[model samples]
Target: MTEASMRFEEGEGFARRMDAEDPLRSFREEFLFPQSPQGEPLVYLAGNSLGLQPRRAQQYVQEEMEDWARLGVEGHFHARRPWLPYHENLTGQTARLVGALPLEVVVMNTLSVNLHLMMVSFYRPTRERFKILIEGGAFPSDQYAVASQARFHGFDPKDAVLKLEPRAGEDTLRTEDILETLERHGSEIALVLLGNVNYLTGQAFDMKALTQAAHARGCRVGFDLAHGAGNLRLSLHDDGPDFAVWCSYKYLNGGPGALGGVFIHERHARAEGLPRFEGWWGNDKAIRFQMGPDFVPLPGAEGWQLSNPPIFQLAALRASMELFDRATMPSLRGKGDRLTGYLEFLLDRLPSGFVRITTPRDVKARGSQLSLRFSKDPRRLLTRLSEAGVCCDFRSPDIIRAAPAPLYNSFQDVYRFVKVLESHARD
Candidate 1:
């Protein structure tokens, strides 16, 4: 449906009609939602923070357990899905989800671990160009990782890290301002790292444009796709960023603390003399089991692996990826746009001075999340939401982030959440 035809209205009936008309509505049954003490499912709107567990995840994980118990050591080679090359099972689906070549993507360690690993190769700092550019107020983990990386290279974080801040009184960064910043400081930058979608304000960046601009300045570019992976229709290969990393627990619905993913551009697949911290698994497969002292790296993203992945994590993720492969990112992203648009429409009708959306109004500039900036003590509002059986997250100081994931969240979920907000505002 076109944006004009969405014709969003503020009532339960309208929400039910939209849910009925939704082509992807059946996908909701694939997930298991949290229940209240009264036995009703909570209106889950926090897919930006943690996605609901996929029902099939339990079954998949159980199969792996059964294999381990029945086969023991032999499971590595004889399990239903061999453990030795198990991560490979996820490669095609992960690559397609993020718009990458299979060779460029790998399921690996947690997000921060992969970020540091990517930095080992891509954040090659030199005397003349030593600064790393990132958006101000990046997710705390990223800020910590970038700061420590600079410190590891004997440079002060203050000098090595440059942050891009929004314009005065603005909540989100403008594309022109970002491009101009790159042009102005391009020569001094060694790496340009950004969250593909800002976790706080739910601002989505122009990866392709930024990559072109950064490359023109001779800077290596990377992104933290923690918020972008499943929420947005990414073109990681076409966008031409050097590398990117993301955790699977959130929109990917890989279960709590599930494995992370990495993407390295094909251009750097076999770049000679590229420095990295290598492990036995990263060695070329033919020689890997030969147990050579020398690390003969595999081509592309798989070459960055530090160790064999946990089988249970891979099993859980396999379940989620199978669902994604069937549903597809394009279809999921389309539904996401409509869901968030309906949410924004309902929110705009709330009492004007009570709260304001910090996320960009332009649909193209955001994913599913809408961050509400409250004028009062937001914690009180959070309490109200919790009591009402609404599930969303609070970001420090004063913001409540709600993301209506299209894969499982219905239009009725969005309507119900707003009704709670409406009730709180009236009080």
Candidate 2:
């Protein structure tokens, strides 16, 4: 049902009815949830930070362990699924997941590593245009990576890096402001890198418009899809960003520390002069074993690989991607919008002045996450939530983030979470 037509009501029975009518309800059983000391299932709403483990992950990982035990060295070529080309198995699903052609996507190193690799090629700064543009409150790791990149290029970060901040009294950036900034500083910007979805406010940016604006200014554009990958319906090829990167651990439901994926537009698939840090795994398959001194990079995103990927990580991610492939992005995104909308509706019913939602109220402008900003210190409330078996997370200062992941979260879960908030309001 569309969000506008979906009627919401107060009471536990309404939540149960919504769950009963949900088309995706059965998918909930696919994951394993954590339990409280009393053997009750914890209300898990932290999928934005780390997704719950898929039940199939263990089975997929166990299969690889068996192959390693049975075939030893020969497992590279002879074992089921094989070891040498294990990363290849994830390519098609990875591509489909992010709306890119298979040649444009590759599953490889962790997020920050892939970001640096993409910068090696896309962030080609010159004497005239040598600045990088990013959000002011980007995840700390991104801040460090871009700043270090500026220093490596012999420019002072304080001068070379430009951070975009929201207008006074606002909690999120406006699309018009972002476009205007790009137009004003277009000449000086060598690269425009942004998180497609802000990790803090859960604001989804207009990547298509941002990419067009940056490209018009002769600047290379990239996105960290760390929060956007599975949470949003992305069309990287259509959006026309030079490159993008994301970790599989969140939303994609891969286990913690799982490998990340990268996307390089097909235009750069075989660009001969593009600068990249080459390694053995990125070498063209035909002559890779020749042990030649010269690096012959493979075509497309695979050309960016630095080494053979970790097999166990790939196997675990493969299991989760399989579910995503079956569920499809369109279906998941539709349900996600509804789930988050329902969460917003329920949260609005809490006592006035109890807490404020920092996430944009526009359903299309956010994913399943909502950031709750409170007037008082929230650490004690967070402790109380844990004690009550609620599984949301607290950011520093006064914000708490709760993500009702549609893949597994039920309407009842949202209802129950708000009930706890109502209790806190009374207290």
Candidate 3:
């Protein structure tokens, strides 16, 4: 059968046929999935949360452990991956994933730590222009980081933070309203900080437009790309945000609490005058061993480093990064759009008022996620999925976020997931 003819149809039979034709279907076997009572792999749709671990991660991690056991201190230089410059090896692939220049990206601390560090450098607040403009209902970690940053700079979170909420009776922020808010409050704002993708609503912002607007208003801009990076084909370099940070654990498929990534625009990559928290590891590489009590920072984003990177975490991440290197964002995204569109199509067939799809219907404005908003308690439905061996996440109040990641998830996985969802509605 023609591959095109096999794509995008309703029901289990067609789903199986489409899966048979998917070029990326084998990628799913590379990761381990949760099992059911019969010891069968469950239908997983929760790549938006913590992603499944890559089977290759074990081999990569074992190499580091063997080096540690045999060479002790010498492993720093002798190890296969070489701990001293481990992070450098990841630069090329990571840069390609986010579409940034190699010098502009670095793998560092966890998501929140990277966010605070970026804030320290770019969120320079003045008495007149001290406020931060962000969307309301941002991930709680971000809200806390911005508030503390305001307090540390001697401003009240109340007066120093401005939130842009959806219009009355709305579920997400509108881009026009964001532009208007910037126009009205632009002069008083020092920084425009926002999540590249709203975690709860799954709304992807027009980052290029937002960056241009903020730059016009004389504000430094940055993005928390924890939800956006591996999911979207972003052009961070061309988009021109001053800085951006993201975690590798979600769609990047690194293990939990895996290292995060940071990107500083080449324009500010080596700005000597930029204010940043100093650390010994960030000192110039040539004189790093000299350690002469004075600090001369590295030329680019690596200058933000605080210490030698954790080699174990970097190794675990390398396994999945290599997979991403093979699949490539464009190929994965092509399959992703249709896989998610099929999920949306089936959900639309749900009985009236059973749920609402909160993520943008316009595919350009969202990634793989579709936030299902149910009037009935979402946890109740979650309990049902849990018993039946479906792997999806439930958020507070009412959101069940199902993401069929293109790299590993198949059309039949989406079909089976919806079939179970339909069964619950009938009950």
List the candidate numbers ranked by lDDT, top first: 1, 2, 3
lDDT of 1 by residue, 40-154 (tens): 8989999888888999999989999999999998999999999999999999999999999999999999999999999999998898899999999799899999999999999
Q: How do the residues 1-427 of candidate 2 rate in per-residue lDDT, one tens digit apiece? A: 7665678888999889889988889889999999966588889999999999999999999999999999998888987999999998989999999999999999999999999999999988899999999999999999999999999999999999999999999999999999999989999999999999999999999999999999999999999999999899999999999999999999998889989999999999999999999999999999999999999999999999989889999999998898888889888888888778888888888888889999998877888899999765588888778888889978889999999888889988988888988888878
Q: What TM-score, over all chains together, does every model reach? A: 0.98, 0.98, 0.97
Task: Name the runs in model 1 displaced over 4 angstroms.
Answer: none
Residue 301 displacement (Å), model 3: 0.7
Worst lDDT window (10 residues) for model 2? 1-10
Instruction: Name the regions of candidate 2 deviating beyond 4 angstroms.
Output: none
Candidate 3 stretches with Cα past 4 Å from truth are: 1-7
Q: For model 3, what is the error of residue 204's alpha carbon versus the real structure, in angstroms, after optimal superposition? A: 0.2
Better of 1 and 2 by lDDT: 1
Q: At residue 423, what lDDT does model 2 achieve? A: 86
- CA lDDT of each prediction against the hidden true structure: 0.93, 0.91, 0.90
